[model samples]
Target: MVVYAPAVLFFLAFCVGVLRDRRRFSNAVFLGLAAVFALAAWLVELIREDEQLGRSVVVGLLVLATLGIVVLAGFLVSNGVTMIRKEGRSPANLLSLLGGVALVGLLALLVAAWVLHTHTLLVVAGTAVALAGYVGFLFLCFISYAFLYGRLHIRRRADYVVVLGSGLVGGSSVPPLLASRLERARAVHARLSVRGRQPVLLTSGGQGPDEDLPEAHAMADYLVERGFPAELVEREDRSASTEENLRFSKSIMEKANPDYRCVIVTNNYHVFRAAMTSRQVGVRGHVVGSATASYFWPSAMIREFVAIFLAYRRTNLGICLALLLGGALIWWMR
Candidate 1:
């Protein structure tokens, strides 16, 4: 209980920081500190305990932590190496370089400790610290989403509603998730229609390998079944990914109405990333989220964060490596 004081304090600080200014990167830093303190508290308890059961638990946790670090490090290395050797010194290459440097520095630290006759417990502790740093990074990725989502606002109405496609059921029917998005899009469309502003509905998705038809067609059909007019619906069936979906749909919208104001509709779990993709694809629009199931939110949010992290893989990896090096230096000094 005593070991948890710092963790509790850091957690409070994090909550306060977010409450004060939820959009800033500094909030992420505070949350990261809280995660580090929490991990440290757990590690300290493991170290202080004397019973066999306690020791076993500590060992198991340490092993799991080490494996997680190794796997993450491996992924960084492989991604970096691939970017360097094939893709050149783009952002991905930079990520690989930073990850490689961190791995080397960590390895050097271990060797130095080995040469200096440091206690085995100290080495284990260092590994735990490294793992904590990586976990903190993962925590930051999730925290960024919460921060972004909290700050987002639907500031204006639009002339068109674009519903981005998720997977289709049997490649011909709208799944519940996609249906929710279409429903939201329809509601928005209906609202605008009632105000004497009828917006075109763009259902965007292409055929994947498992699908028998394009996702856009399925979405269009679903919207029609829900009593949306067929003439008001447009299909973008050539897009194979989110980027393509937005880009292709934007092209379609631009051709019909060059000065188009649009809002993208996706599931609540996907709104942030979809907006980011919209920005990336040069779509001039905001995003609106439909409802998602409570049980699905955690995993779906995690997936969205990972997708965003990978989208800017180099910068994110560089930041993580910097944090890793800082943690390693602290471990060495101790």
Candidate 2:
């Protein structure tokens, strides 16, 4: 019973953080910690009550964990193949496949290190494992919190609905991917309108070298063609990236109403990152996601995670270096 105290505290902390601002990444860490400690407490209580049952549970968990890793690695690899086949052989499309190969290679290295019992192999495998563990923990937190965040309902009225653009299809047309976002924005707009609060829909995207016009213009056109009021559809056509999208949109939103509250609409895989970005750019908004194609999600999610990982590279890379140095010290001692 008492073993669960830490879990309870962490859970409370998670609740507090989420209530304050669900966009913060630290809230995800707290939630992950709560789940971990709860599991640990449960295992401890089980061991106290029945040693055999506890041991069996522990062994089962280990087997399940290993099997899960193998399955995930295989799935990522296969999905990568699917992505390449459907979306072309771009570097972005290779992320899931590369991630899977990396995982498999790490596992093989660990196995060989155990078999060879050599200092060099041990050091390499230990360092790789530690780095992977850190990354995997962050990935878990990201995925779990993203799932939680997307499902949360906003009860307040929004002054605007912002749709972040992916890109224009065929240089000037709205693709299904971008259309999904517009549809979602329309839904949000309709809901607000029903409540007698007419929120302006702000479409944010810029002209690419290959694009016929700015993505925001095409998005705004799409909305108008679908019966959205032309006057209500505003375009911010200078953002070439997500950060720029939010930053530029924030400027527009601030000029319209300094204390404005809004809702950002993007794809499901993008919602968390967009929310984080919105917070970063001082946007008074929460992000909601539209459905993305199933085939595109894995690689897209990997890409999103990579962006976030690099966004905090200083802390992440510092920890990786310390882990590597610690492993090298162990190898030298051996």
Candidate 3:
């Protein structure tokens, strides 16, 4: 019972963070830690109650964890194959394949280190394991928080519905991915309208070198073609990236109404990152997610995590370097 205090505190912090502002990434980290400590506390309690029962539980959990890893590796490999077969062999589609192969290779390294009984192999495997553990923890935090955030109901009415654009399919055509976001924005607008609130729907994007038109223009056109009111739709067509999208849209919303509240919309895979960005840019909004294709989600999610990892590269890189140094010291001692 005393051991559970840390878990209780972490959960309280998570609740407070979410209540104060739901967009912070730290909230996710807190929630993840809460779950981890809760599990640890349970394990301790089980061990205290009966040593044999505890041992059985521990062994069963380890077996399940191992099986989960194996299954995950297989799924990634299979999804990679499906991506290649269906979408062609672009670099983006190759992420899951590369990840799966890398996981298998890492497992192999651990086995070789054990079998060979070599200090050098052990050092290498140990370093890899430490780095992977750190990354896997952060990833767990991210995915769990993302899932939780996406499912939260937005009860407050919004003054605006902002749709973040994905690139067009051809030179000017609205792709299914971008269309899904527009459809979501339209639905939000419709819901607000039915509630007697005239919320503005803003499309945010910019022209790329190969694009025939700005993504915002294409998105707005798509909504118009589908019979959403042209008058309520506005365009912010200068943002080149997601940060720029939020920043530029914030400027427009600010001028029209300095205190405007809004809902930003993107795909489910992208919702958490967008929410974080919206907060960064000082937007008074919560984000909502549209649907994404199942085959495309794994690679897309990997890309999102990579972007986030790099965004906090200073801290993450510092941690990895420290782990490497620690591993080096152990090898030197041997």
Q: List TM-scores for all candidates, in order.
A: 0.61, 0.96, 0.97
Off by over 4 Å in 2: none
Cα deviation at 250, candidate 3, in Å, is 0.6
The sequence of per-residue lDDT tens digits that candidate 1 reaches over residues 137-185 is 7656565655566356653567789989988877677888888999988
Lowest-sum lDDT 10-residue window in model 2? 152-161
The CA root-mean-square deviation of candidate 3, after full C-alpha superposition on the true structure, stands at: 1.3
For candidate 2, write residues 76-149 as lDDT tens digits. Answer: 99999999999999999999999999989988998999999988998898889889999998999999999999
Superposed by TM-score, candidate 1 places the C-alpha of residue 150 at a distance from the truth, in angstroms, of 6.7
| Every candidate's lDDT | 0.73, 0.92, 0.91
Candidate 3 lDDT over residue span 1-334, tens digit each? 8999999999999999999999898898899899999999999999999989998999999889768778888899999999999889999899988888878888889889999989999999999999988888888899999999999886467888999988987779999898899998888788778878899999999999889999999999999998988999999999999999999999999999998999999999999999999988899998999999999999888878888899899999999999999999999998
Which residue pairs of candidate 2 clash? none
